[model samples]
Target: MSKGKFSSGVDLPLPVNAPGVTKQERAYQAIRDAILNGLLQASDRLPSTRVLSQRWGIARGTVESVFERLQLEGYITRKVGSGSLVSAVIPDSYLKAVTDTRTGEPDRNESVEIEETPVRQEGRYRAQVGVPFVARLASPLLIAPAEWAAHLQRAMAAMKPEQMCDVEPQGAWVLRDQIAQYLRKHRGIDCRAEQLLITNGIRHSIDLVARCVLKPGDDVCVEDPGYPAVHRIFEKAGANLLYAPIDNEGIDLHGISDSAECRLAYVTPAHQSPLGVIMSATRRLELLDWAQRQNAWIIEDDYDSEFNYQSAPLPALKSIDSMKRVVYCGSFNQALFSNLRLGYILAPPELHHRILALWHTIGRSVGVSEQLGLAEFMRGPAFLRHLRRSRQEYQTLRDIVLDTLMAEAPGRYRISGEHAGFHLILWLSPDQDEDALVREAERLGLMLQPLRNSCREIDLPPAFVLGFAALTRAQARNSARQLARLLH
Candidate 1:
């Protein structure tokens, strides 16, 4: 029999762990004791067999055998991508008979009794926007569950105990290094790992930059009718925002005067939010030149540059920025699952330390496990393979939605923008009451958002940003038909 502590730091004494017991029996008793004593609560994840074996000074095969026995006994469950989770269903008798080894009584397990979880229904909506609909977003074919699981386990197994202790505010060095290489190959951004700071998401990245750069009441140029969330983040940072409207080419430089004199400007150059237009290369150079002349910073929010079906994605704005004034931001939220909330910011070399300092001051750090997992995911063929498959699938779905709308709506609507991105804008005649249409759609159990929701410029035309990434081809057809009937 061997003795060790549970991952949760609880100690347990079991008959199987006593002298003369076989190693397998001792392993079984240790797990059972951990479960009943609340050291491993229901739904809690168990360490991988490799991690367990290393920790216990035992063979990996023995740990695997123990896991197999636990699975057969219904003590744990395993999912393909996500590893082992403790079983929620504990035999009622075990809870009642659980022993308090310290007290030589049966009371400890009672304290950690698991509660039943309730089932809830997903909200029913039609034509949802801004939210990533999990069912419609990434296809499983692109993201192989078994492969993801294997990569995740390997990443976990590769971690040293000390590596998991505390994450750097700049993020895991390995993930940042991979991101640097990924950006160079994919987005044409020339940067090193030192310039990249890992963040919870784009919002956090923006906040960190604002904290390090903006003083209270400083002017910041933001695209009008852009990502509303970015506006909110800058507002919270105490910026006096200049709403610069965007045209078909991209952000309207004419809209901002020479005297506008802003410290920073935010632009979605890759694919403009809500409008889906790629910022032209000429305009890209102009923006960079303006930033250099004004001695200002540019925050390029490269949102959804991965799913371009029309043309090859333009090199990132930062690639053309010889002035070192661009702070490039990208998020895995839209590319991966939204809940993951992993993002990165590539700061200028001059400001990198300041941004890192601010990041550390705020104590913002992503979980080491996910960072390591993503590092491994990107290091292999998985990430790029998934990106290719998803881009192809999304283009198919986009075509379906566009075709259905054209056939059904006829003269009532026109696609204002559709060259790239997961969503596009349907421009209705200015006379059409956008609010009334939205209300009627809601009454019909379809959710529709008016263009006004994303705009700060009041005179913009009436349109609806239609998100098609989450809709299946059949759903798109049905939704279009339903809207056509309502319109007629």
Candidate 2:
């Protein structure tokens, strides 16, 4: 058909001469790559052997042999008169998942397969409407599906054959270039594409850094009531997790110093999880200074810096890190849909290749189509427009939660972390039993995440992190009343 090229989808290219590889082998490889890369989509019609051989300038016999191999491998189905069609069930679902060389296990598709994805007028993710979310987090409206689909279409259509064959482990250079620009503009971080590494998400970024640096029994510092998963990631890498209690300014510097042995620290300075306090500029400087002096790296998880409702959000900790001690981590999952699983790490120039080397050693990568599509999306003005709409919508939701809860039960509890993020902390009196409240809430058909879950050693007043991003007006009010009643 001679379809135009794209990263999300494209036409196969003719095989070029190789010193040792046979013409048959090269032809086979090209078709197989097309199938794997979604350049030949599920159930798409394939060109007739005669047409392909003539078009690609390959020998008729070699083209026929290639087709035979593809058919035998179930990559295509041949019907005598109907011509050949691509398999209805392709091995790779839009995104190619290669077998991990180390584990010998094929990676699972992270994105859900859509038989027919419908784009609503409001551009909501239809699949997430009633789906049970992981991590007790909620996503706001951050993407225009119709526009996103169009961008993806363009992304696929624009891919050249060479791109499918040569994938970068550090990430697609175009995507990294966009990210470098995005960070500089949005987060005030000054970095080049060379310093950026695209990851599956923040956890993946952290895991890679941990693997690259940590040895068995090495000490890693974290905010006491920080992201629980970060704690586990550090622990999984055989490092002893040390807790640095978070205060009003941010993770306590004094608490961090208690672990003179620690060389790595993870902080959520943008909006600390559960507690929701922006790390003060002074504290940011202090943390950066500490990391520089101690020769340690600070993992600054930039959570919810995009959705600040009060004032313009502060610049990211990484922006202030003149010492290059902060390794900035963030993801599109919270901003986009959860399954996007696309994130980035802006490491210091010195740490970039070490992290890249670890990424290379792992030999796992997010599919080329998603990367190219995302890069295309970010390259346009559409992303900022979508982000603005999302921020406005989430602000309205945040107001609803604040108003409903305040009117229903004044002074019953104090809310923290409400200035930013999809979730906020409902802090009850210290005497209140947080665990019992959580259990009672679940019994009442509501999920309440206990603050203790994020904390390792810091003892605090009873509190629960309340997620409200996806709640409708009615749901917000009803849930507020339900939670207010529980306090009684």
Candidate 3:
């Protein structure tokens, strides 16, 4: 073995005692215990074999053998130049074994629970309103692990030293490039990599933009009956919010207070949040013209556009903007599930530096390994295929729930906004009180969100946003029937 120090600078904890086992076995067991006990988390880099051998006063070959065993058993994943990293996918069997060793009882709980569903004290999984569900794509989930793992391994292997530490505040350049290309090809939004900034998610993107653009007490226009998070994000950034009601065509710009002196406008033009209305071309153009005339910035949140089932998704508002006043925000969290936390903002060329500077001031950036893995995933064919699969699955779930609703409460309720998006609006009559209805539904263990809760200035008819994407066919059917029973 060569007497040299580790090239990889990561520090890993080695066990103090190596009793009752060979040197190689001791090394493997210690590293494995650290991983299982959460001392070494997913994507945490393991030190080089040279370092491990030097630390333990063993031959480097022994450390290499231990690494090989762990890799073969799937406890660790190794790449040519990236060294080794703890695998994110921990096997249930391995977990059970570790638990048995600790407490002398094996862990038999292997059931997988969806993060979006809340577990009640009564021991039932309750699907809440505005929360995502994931029952449709089983076995090979949306982002296939085997495929993604291969790409991730490749990305890690190709990663350079400078790429790992002190990452760019705007995000990895490779991801930005991939996002720019994706926007051009899929969203019809033309932008260079220099004009894009990777964000944690839509909330983070909007917060950053608000800090950059709005001074304290500056007026900002937001869609009424919109995502409440939008209002909260702006409020935290010290902007005074103005309300603009949304119709079937999207946000009613005509209804906005003309005297509000709004400096910024936030609208979900593609499959409007909680309502599923696609913004009409005329309205989109009018909004862009308004932004230009008022010297205001339009934040176009194009979240969840990939799952559109109606027509091919309309060209984004940013695509047609001739005045360079729109900042387009998009999120993979909705499309790939909430834990992904990967989103991007396509800012105008002028605002790029300001956005980058704001991100630096925040001093928090997304994990580099995941960013690189996603960049690799987007550059391949799997991501598009995954979108197609999810769209089809969501459409089926939507149809099942819609059919159940119509069959159970034919003339009692009206449904709208079902032409696209993962959710539909269940519009109630004028006499029906939304608050009481939601409360009653909750008492019956059916989580229904009141549509009026999202409204600030506009008093609209009572309704609920029914998200069907995360539900299984049987769960959707049962839930719809239960809801229909409540109505009757």
- What is the lDDT of every predicted structure here? 0.71, 0.71, 0.72
The digit string of per-residue lDDT tens for model 1 on 350-391 reads: 676677766676676578888888899999888888888778
- Candidate 1: lDDT of 267? 95
Candidate 3 lDDT by residue in tens digits, 369-451 = 98998898888887788888878887887888888878997777888878677678888866666777777787876767667
lDDT score, residue 91, model 1? 37
Best by lDDT: 3
CA deviation > 4 Å runs, candidate 2: 1-136, 140-144, 430-433
Tens digit of per-residue lDDT, candidate 2, span 1-488: 23322233224675677665577766766876566444666567777788778867778888887776566434676888887776634332123222242245432211222211111211222234422111234454446678778988999999999888976667788898898888876676777876677899888899999998889998888887887767888999999887888887677878555447778989888788768887754455556657656778888888567887764455677764545577889898777777787999887756766777777776756888888999999998877777787778777867787787788778788888887887788889656677787788777766776777777789887777777776666766677777777776
What's the TM-score of every candidate structure?
A: 0.70, 0.71, 0.70
**Model 3 poorest ten-residue lDDT run:** 114-123
Clashing pairs in 1: none
